[model samples]
Target: MSTLPRSLLKNLDLFRSVSEHDLDTVLQIAQTMRLQAGEPVFQQGQVAENFYILLHGHLKVVQTTPEGEQITVRYVMPGEVFGIARAMRRPTYPAACIAVEESIVLSWPSSEWDHVIARNPQFAFNALQTVGQRLQDAHTRIKELSTEEVEQRVARCILRLVDASGEQTEEGVSINFPITRQEIAEMTGTTLHTVSRLLSSWKEQGLVNTGRKRVTVRRLDDLIRLAEGQPPGGTAASKRNSVEPL
Candidate 1:
């Protein structure tokens, strides 16, 4: 827990502006927890009694449809605070947070939220900013779902994840966490079969590579063009991208 103190928080926008004295108080109340890959951090509709900060690793914020389909809203990266229902004045979490990889989390009782905010006005402003950004992202996704084609939505989702947690590789940019096409379907409001067909076509087009639980963007420019409206189908992984018949 040595790393859980205020010094590390200086890198975080939410806490960087907090006074040393006020940050120390937050440190005093902070509790740390670890979760294994594929573990549930919190279930949907659970009492949002605490605020959580991701110190290490990634998670997915998801909601389940009435038919039991999982809809992935977004990925939670390290240094981000989650389970924000407390700040939003919600009694329960609207979605589940699941660890996509092994994770370390810092938590604080929601009862102490107001105390921390009063001590550090910047904290409140930061929280508002975080919530506002989240809402804005939600709005963007809603607009995409309603207006964009499925191919466009999936392409945008993959590109965003790439920007969020991608690592450079000889092959291209690989997502740092394990992800399946089914999850992509959930994120894009499509079916597994549809996602598979598109990915298979993308693979042929030399835009992406897929493995057991991985996806790598082999040609981002091509993918961006495809996402924008170009069809997919090609023979070689060429810098010159085109949509040929599979």
Candidate 2:
């Protein structure tokens, strides 16, 4: 009871159509879990046994590279549904989900999915929507990777995070999650050195202020300009020099 995430029907748009009784019935199949930061909720290629709804805190989706390097695909915020590999008919997870901080989730076995969705049509709709969204996000990332340079991709990634779960503060707009330069580099398909150097340059130009596990955009417009290849207060001559490996 206490484990149930703030009524799913209220927080998740896809579940809005489900009645409390229906929602509760589905939840009856759920098991609540608390995970420590850095712990894995699910590993890549593991059996797909459960579907999860993040109750609190954050999660990172990661995939392994050919060289055995782990690249971050995306970050999940609270109230989102994840671990839907069964919905895709995959016997194993394609990627891993790890907790970014102490987090809670409600999970249900894949075996119960049909029963749950049949009794709650909205559940089926929502599951499909969630999977569809993952496809769209992947498509967008592919476009960015092919069309944008490292700096632009990194800038867009930061802005996307800020837009997703940022909190406005006296300092500036900060991403409301624990993120490291290595993870950002992985997410943008670049090297950590590149991300660190670009961030250092941005800080000097007053475009952004970064801290441990936090990034605050001081000039979002300028960052957007930079992402579009517009040199912000810096000339074209300096742009190449400012962002190395361009």
Candidate 3:
């Protein structure tokens, strides 16, 4: 835990302003778990006995409706703290967290949730900040789904991914994580066919390049124009009354 503490806590927002000594103590109680791709870290409605921090790889937070449809709430990158049901005042997990690839996470028992918070003032503030940001992002996604066209929604979804984990490439910015059109559709409240068609058109227009589990933005400005509800060559107002495809 001594060696792991400095490197893991250095860049994490949850550990903002935390002392190296305090972080070391917290890491001592954490248990590490490694998951394979498609494996679930926790299921919705499961007893929330622990909270977790993603140490490596990616995860998708998903919720299933009574109709058996799954909605992708968001993607979790490394350094994210999740499954904090105690923070939400819930006794069970609100959604399922599944690994997008091979991953590692450090988890602590829920019993320590209060002690951890009390031990570090900055941790509480950082935790609340993370939760607040998630709330804001949810609002923005809802607004986009309610008001934007399919193409606009798709574009915004990709842009969000690009902002989160994109890496510079010779061609343009590439989403560093593996993602598929189906997952994009789930995130944007659309269908796979619609997502595929939009990506295909964008590829043909030289705005993006897409392949199996990969997407690279070739012309970011043009993509932003589309996301803003203005085509690359024309201006258009956002369709406020439009409903996203099911």
For lDDT, the strongest prediction is 3
Each prediction's TM-score against the native?
0.89, 0.89, 0.90
Q: After superposition, how far is residue 108 of candidate 3 from its true place, in Å?
A: 0.7
Model 1 pairs whose backbones collide: none
Check candidate 3 and list the clashing pairs. Answer: none
Worst 10 residues of 3 by lDDT: 237-246
- lDDT, candidate 2, 72-123, per-residue tens: 9999888788898887789999999999999988888989878877877776
What is the C-alpha local distance difference test score of each model?
0.83, 0.83, 0.85
Higher lDDT: candidate 1 or 3? 3
For each candidate, C-alpha RMSD in Å?
A: 4.0, 5.3, 6.2
Which lDDT tens digits does candidate 3 get at residues 61-140? 99999999988889998888889997789999999999989999889999999989998887788778779999999999
Residue 69 alpha-carbon offset, candidate 2, angstroms: 1.5
Index of the highest-TM-score prediction: 3
